[model samples]
Target: MSTTKWSIDTAHSEIGFKVKHMMFTNVSGNFEKFDASIETEGDDFTSAKFDFSGEIASINTGNADRDNHLRSGDFFDAEQFPTLTFKSTSFEKESESDYKLTGDLTLHGVTKSVKLDVEFGGLAKDPWGNTKTGLSATGKINRKDWGLNWNSALETGGVLVGEEVKLNIELQFIQQ
Candidate 1:
């Protein structure tokens, strides 16, 4: 089998997330700087190996003050941790266009196994002639799982920030 390498088309991809705030509303955020790579044997996604990293300093939640707080020691501690990463342990195809991806996610110096649901978007050739593929992945994780334990108790009986964080990733990769 021949090995195939793929590089992320950053311009067409996004690493985004959402979290419940005050037990009522959802706050969304995204990483402005990140990279990912994938390798497979002869275009077979089931044999894929994935690696990804997102810069903590590049986090954006629309509000600068909130973004800064997320980068502070109370949260990501961007100056110390700098980045969050993931390395896939398994890529199992559950159907023609669905997959189960299990990986080790490292954030704030803590590592844990996580699972994500992936939907294949098929392959296509861009206008520039680059062969590309797209994938959408979703999952949920507890911020405290990675040492992001800073929070406040709301006077109304709920916490300021919810424990669960929802992940929504859209990725496009070009064959290399």
Candidate 2:
């Protein structure tokens, strides 16, 4: 196998999530610290080895109180978990620039298989002659499945936080 190694360009990547807040609007946040890598057999990403992890303490929502609470036992419990991670199990190409990636995602002390839809952004050459590529991955997971069950019954009717969490990952990798 002609395996090629690539490292994530952190400055060009972001890991973000959104969930329904209350029942009307959605609250979004992102992890400020994350790392990922790619190991492919060739130029084609049809099948590749991918892995990633993000610091739980780096959760940011533009609100310090909520961020701190997310790092607490009521949510991520950063002291005990410290980080969230994903290790790919399968990577299947959908047509030309589309793909489906299945992996094990661990969060808040629980591990579960999840799938992400990927859109390849193609490869390019940087000003310094480095080979770089970009892609966007999207997925959804039920927060309760990962033990993040903290919630409150709103007097309006529904719970405070929604169960489904949407994940958005924008990644750029430089060929190593």
RMSD of each candidate relative to the true structure: 0.6, 0.8
lDDT of 1: 0.97
Name the best candidate (by lDDT).
1
Q: How far is candidate 2 from the true structure (C-alpha RMSD, Å)?
A: 0.8
Extract clashing residue pairs from model 1: none
Give the alpha carbon lDDT tens digit for every residue of 7-116 in model 1.
99999999999999999999999999999999999788997999999999999999999999999999999999999999999999999999999999999999999999
Let me know the TM-score candidate 2 reaches against the reference structure.
0.98
Model 1: how far residue 162 lies from native, Å:
0.5
lDDT of 1 at 100: 97
Candidate 1 root-mean-square deviation in Å:
0.6
Tell me the whole-model lDDT of each prediction, alpha carbons only: 0.97, 0.93
Tell me each candidate's TM-score.
0.99, 0.98
